[model samples]
Target: MAKTVGDFILERVQGWGVNRLFGYPGDGIGGLVAALGRNDDLEFVQARHEESAAFMACAHAKFTGEVGVCAATSGPGAIHLLNGLYDAKLDHQPVVAIVGQQSRSALGGNYQQEVDLQTLFKDVAGDYVETCMAPSQARHLIDRAFRIAKSRRTVTCVIFPNDVQEAKAVEEAPHAHGTVHTSQAYSEATVLPQEVDLERAADVLNAGKKVGILIGAGALGAADEVTKVADLLGAGVAKALLGKAALPDDLPFVTGSIGLLGTEPSDWMMQHCDTLLMVGSRFPYSEFLPETGQARGVQIDLDPTMLSIRYPMEVALAGDSARTLKALIPRLKRKEDRSWRGEIEQRIARWWREEEERAMKDAKPVNPERVFWELSSRLPENAIITADSGSSANWFARALKIRPGMKASLSGTLATMCPGLPYAAAAKFAYPDRVPIAFVGDGAMQMLGVTDLITVSKYWRDWLDPRFVVCVLSNGDLNQVTWELRAMANSPKVPKTQDVPPMSFAHYAELLGLKGITVETPEQVGPAWDAALRADRPCLIDAHVDPDTPSLPPHISFSQAGSYAEALVKGDPDESGILTQTFKRVFS
Candidate 1:
């Protein structure tokens, strides 16, 4: 039998060291699916939907630093991949999406499932998106997609028309004028700033009495360097949400998360610091940072464009986080003043006590903060944790204490929902020996988590450790958006839009032949997690938490307070509970 274009593409991807492809089956991609079946080297992970597949690919890239690949059919299946691919693009993860197109002859004829895939993928896969018009084009398209996705750390796409996919494969391009030759070779360069710039950045840090260091996802590999710099400069370190695992939370001068879902110590450090060094984080909220001109600023980022856009830096070094910090550390003089570090440590200690007090506050049933706080102490070493957007993210940012060696992330820039389970599953696949836990809300669980559970049930038995746990906060409300209406829009929550329909997520997991536990009281929260972690298979914990428990910002402005008052005056459906919870959280 002659090798087809589909078979050749898979062979090329396997050559690039991709061991798995995530996607769903469809007739448009029948050729590729058949080729995949024939190939034993590459495993195909079947996701419930194309969106989940894309998310899995994104998470794969995030967890394993490799180019993740996902495939789907034409039209709706291809469209479903957009959101997840955008999440990859925004968060700067490498992902290659392979989608099927209709027959070439029927492309312009508007045949069934024939959408303009090129234009559809242009925005998400803006760096590269091309169609394989012939067997000869397949090699270059596949090569370029993987290379560009890996080199650029963004999403890339390759569209395969149904007819072209089944055509005879062309392993190599001819050495002619029109033919193009490409190879599956890419290597990440170690970027470092010039000595002159590193010295200037060091000078700025040395001159300041109170220095603050901000780390983001870019600093994940530079933990030791960041710590050395912090200790030498007597600086307090604050983490952006994406960089939660960049540094351990147990450090004395390490303030927790920064920005809206930040800790008081982080906000305080930002407000009072005399010099600020921002590393590999584009945290988006300028108000949360030190006021302009009040502090000397320096920033380091691999992407030159991201360098000084968030905060104006006197020295903007375009380089890798670990390497830049290492170069800068040699030039920095150790600060003898220990007063600032001591003050920051005191604030952090007080903040944790406050967090504990807030988490333990009584609510209608289970307090959501307590769920995460309890999990923080029980998180297994080397565990990978993912949280969905919504109230779950609020608690994830504030309550959870990420220790060293534990990997954690979410849809950082996109802040999208329903990626938690998919991310965890991808993490488990990447490190079969490590446990992966997902913190999700009922709304997200209802949206897609429930269906993805079957994906877990199917794959768990093969994993070295069958300890995938999905912790669902069943609050019966779209709690995050509801609070945003009151705090941001100054409007009362409209029950019709804010309320979520309840579902038995635990029961659903049990039906899929996985363990299930329900926690209706605060006492059950800790025990439930213990049970789930010990289960022989994947487990789901349905924690029925209070809907009115406030996800308060570290510090509230007068305007936000005014909006809350206005919303309450306008008669919010849960005004009484909201007021009570707000008071308890504020005064605790």
Candidate 2:
């Protein structure tokens, strides 16, 4: 007799440290769910939707540095997962998606819940596979899932055939066989370019001009190296938002974020610097790139593939950030460039001061960014923050300053809507003692299933005073896309979709038995967030926002703008509606 595929899945998942599953189960996945129920080590999440399940798993994996798992049945359930998978891939967030297949006997017979599960996600998932015999292929699929989840840091889906899931195992119990490999990359010392390359680089730095370092995601673990190299070369730090946590935001050598949506200081610094050191960052927006009249960028990355992919570069060097920075640190002298660091420091201080002032502002509608910053200040050290895309994520990234030792997870792409609630749930699942705050736009919260907060509340409440601060900015539109469209294309007035109406997130939250607050005024944001965090269970602060005040778009190239502007000016639109839209924006 052959053991069932579901049993083998549980056995293998146990090896990968997967104790719980996240998802909404349908009839197609029943056998697997039953198998999960039988296994003590593996539990099920029971999310409100399949998309949220994948998102929760993605967030869990990002913070825990392990494979986070989610599951769903066939057809529409499986379809819901693609959007989240796209985001996980771009951000390199680790996740495993286990979906059900139509019974094996139903293959090519026009089955009810049928989908070519493996092929459907081939383009998006780093690894796509299906389970067969539990003793052999099932265990092997588990290994593949873990590998893709770890190496590619993206979603890996295993479609379990219903009949195969019910088959008996040849062995008394199934065996799981995924293993973790911890190999270190070794670099052999190479001869330096005889002081000439260093001389040129040093000359660029020592010139009587401003110098800056632009940071990105690749510098996460190499903050010290980046800092040391900057200190030795007298370069100021201005990081991409994705690299926000790379170093202490309050560091004296720091300016701020540089790009279109960036602070004024970051814009000034990027424009003023004569030499720019690109360390482990591959920021996509070209608008933030220093103009040709200003600074020239020198990119340093682990892979040469990232160089010149998005923006033009003066030089591209392939090397580990820390190792390269270590080599460069000693060769450079540490003399101040007079007003260079001082000017940046003053600008940063001014921004910080304005941020402080914003914290004190009183208005009819609370600013979401101001609320996030306030909530961040009150949270305990090392508190987890999971943010969805849109205004909420932008505000969280902008306002929730990353302290050196603290951990965070935010969607680095724009594929999914409501990842916040599920992400917070996963963070709590992994570290129950450390409360995780999930920030999301109102449009996203509804899309994600906020009521599922009760599911987590059921098991983890005893972790004591459950502090999952789900701050929902309720302006009722997908503001991130709207803002981008306004800038990228001359779309007149913000377009309104008749697909959905203004939603009440606060009402829905309380219906789920979680504590809730409505922040109609800015004065109430801090107090509301503080109260929610102090509550002993799940809570939400429906922070009403001014929909009119949109998050500005990040910078990009003038050529791209010229193309769109020409389309607008030449009265060339694909449709009358497009022309009408363009007219609205032009007038606005």
Candidate 3:
């Protein structure tokens, strides 16, 4: 008997070890979803929006080291999946998006919400293929989809036509979906750099000149090896934003992050180190980096694409960071760098203390920065935090003063939206006992199905219940980029005048069977926070923030700031007293 497309998909997913899929029920995939319903080994979770579903899938993929799956109908549903898919791609996550296409006959011309599905998605999916009339070949198609997702660590789209979804059956074994590995092949021999290159690198370290190592996310699992390399070579280490948790900042040789958002030690090392070893980092900040005349830079990456993509390197080797360091350990000669390491250490310590002081000193009504800082300080050593992209990314990155014990962090690519909630939820799912905070911005709140908040409240609740508190910085509008655009449109005429309608996200939470609290003043924030930490149910803290308050990032251009200056003076041509709120929010 020929197997139905539905049976083929189930067996294929089971074969690829995908037991859960983040998706929603709609007219497009009714047959497919129903078929999935009968499979006890697979789980189908319907999300509020396609973006949220995709995000959940991405997080699941990241945490489990497997290709996370999300499904959506064609047209609007498939469109929404792009944001998360883009995020997954940039973050190097394995994601598979199974989108239901309209009937084959209706695809070419606009019947209703028709789009050329294949053409629309080909560019987006790093790897993509469409199954036209091959219902019998569904198993192989799904298998190839999984292969693309894992090999490229990218989002792969598989468009399944609707008519053949519910045909027949196939006999399958349970073992197919039980074993899968997301880890790539890393040859040990690849670890041994050419003797000539190793000697050159070792000679520089042994020369007694100051050396520093900058690590990125690629070095996450190699912290111990990095430390071993540092110990033998007397090198100090700092990380990039993506690499913040790669090593314990408390280590005497470990400094903080680099970039404009980076700490003093990172900046100091870029300037002082005569020889720099960058492990698993593709830092594009050429301005902060020294010219070739001062310091020779070395980099080790598993992917060859990273080499010469941005800054030129004195040496670039494709190898496993941990194994490569281990191989180089014996070849490296130890050198004394007490003072060199001490200087960077002092700067890291000062930056840590200064950030704490800065957050503590800013006690005011609706200070979003202060909100982030306090949360970071109060979280336990092993707390896991997920930050949404947009204002939340900057606000949290700048304010959430992380100590060495932070266990996990997931960030969006530069300025996207809709990841914070699911990433937080997934982290909570991964480690139920740890306090997971979803630091979100109001703009992206509705985009995530709030119903998931109920899922969180039901299974994971408080200190004893494994808390998942969503702290939404509420400004009622997504002003992340538009504020700057408005400022840049024209020169100052006097402050412009505009006001967004008021919104109460807290009330929305109350309806979801979860504790909801809103704080507009600094005085009430402390207690609100305490209640959330201690609450026996999942909670949401709607923090009414000043829209004008500059996020202390993007370092708003002088032109934009001046333009904003005039916009405030005008004060909507209606509301006059609100000028103080705008100026203090942005300029201050």
Candidate 4:
């Protein structure tokens, strides 16, 4: 039997260790679909929508640290992948997308389902994008796509025309440069800094009496090293949202999260530190950062491009997180005075007390924090959690405690909705033995949660375990946007635009042959979580939380306070009167 270009592409992808491809079937990709059916090594996950497939691929890469792959037909199918692909690109995850195109003979004819994918994906896949024009080009193009994606930690796109995919492979061809059948493997190598760089970083740390550390997802494997460095320098550590798992919450001097959705102590630590050591993070929001000349800085990143991009650095060390920390630890001088660390720890303790107070509030309806606090206590040590954007993210950021073994992920860069459910499904597929939970906003859940629950039911028994839970924070409003309207602008709420109809996501789950639980009060939150965790199939928990609870920053500016005041004066319904409730929860 003569092999086709599709055969070669699948073989190369399998060789590179991609065991699954998430996509939807369509006419533009019929050839590739046929090829996917022939390859037993690759399992194709059929999503209800191409967008969810792309989101699944992005989540898979985030969890496994490998180049995740997704496929789609050209035109609309390819366009549907943009949102999730952007999620991967912005977060610096390795992902490869394959899109089907019209036959070469029909080029520029405006054929049915024809579109220019290269231009469409240029921004998202700036690192690599090309069409497979011939059978001989399959091996080189596929290998290069994987190589660039893994090495650069960016997205890569390959467009396959229908005719080209069906073409028979030739032993010798015009496009052939080398052996077409040879196998090659590639892996990202550890990057380390020079001795001089490490010494300079140590000098920066040693000169300051009060040092602070900002850790990101790049520092995931270097928790011990990061703690050692912090202990040696008497530094308080603040984690970026993506880096929440870098250190356990129980660590005394570590602040949970930074920026708008951050703890009060983290903002204080960032403002007061004389020197800042940044590892594996290119955290934006320079407004939250120390002012110019406020602190001497040392930044360590594997990508040289990211070093010192956020702030001016006295020393920039380009290296792997664990290796760089290991090298620099030996040259550091331990601080004798533990007062700074003690003060920061005290602030952290106070912050936790505040969080607990907020969680324990007995508002008329239900406090959103109560649900997260219950989940925090009930979550398995090894659970993988996903949070959708909006108020749900604020609760997840502030309330959850990410232990050393646990993993938490969000659309940090894209900040897109409708990804939480897909992310949980992907995590469940990737780590079947581990529990996967999605903390999703009512808006985001209504957008795709029910549809993806069907996908979950389809693949539930395909894996070793079926323990997936989707927690819907149903407040019947776009709570975060509403808060933004009140907190950022001194305007009355746009009643029609911001409010969502009350939805029964739990009932929707049950309709799809899955378990469902609805919690309207504080007491029901814990028992609902308990039921979801014990269920053998996927479950949904619909939590009716207070919509008026404001996610106020630790340090609210005068202007922001004025804005909130103005909104309250200008006919903003103090309906649940949760503003006073929330105010006391934060200040009192």
Give the candidate number with the greatest TM-score: 1
Q: What is the TM-score of each candidate against the true structure?
A: 0.99, 0.83, 0.84, 0.97
lDDT of 4 by residue, 528-554 (tens): 999999998888998998887777786
For residues 99-197, what per-residue lDDT tens digits would candidate 3 score against the true structure?
877777676677675767787777668576565444545655577678777766778888776765755543332345543323222222444567777
Over 4 Å off in model 2, which ranges? 1-3, 126-135, 170-209, 292-296, 302-304, 314-328, 358-363, 454-465, 476-478, 481-488, 492-504, 550-588
lDDT values, one for every candidate: 0.92, 0.68, 0.69, 0.87
Summarize candidate 2's per-residue lDDT along 355-413 as a digit string, tens digits. Answer: 66554443336555677778756877777777777667666655666677766667775
Question: Which ten-residue region of model 4 has the weakest summed lDDT?
Answer: 170-179
Candidate 3, 79: how far from true, in Å? 1.8
Which candidate number has the best lDDT? 1
Query: What is candidate 3's TM-score against the reference?
Result: 0.84
lDDT of 1 by residue, 254-361 (tens): 899998999999999999999999999998999999999989999999999898998889999999998888888879999998999999999999999988999999
lDDT score for residue 368 of model 4: 89
Order the numbered candidates by TM-score, best leading: 1, 4, 3, 2
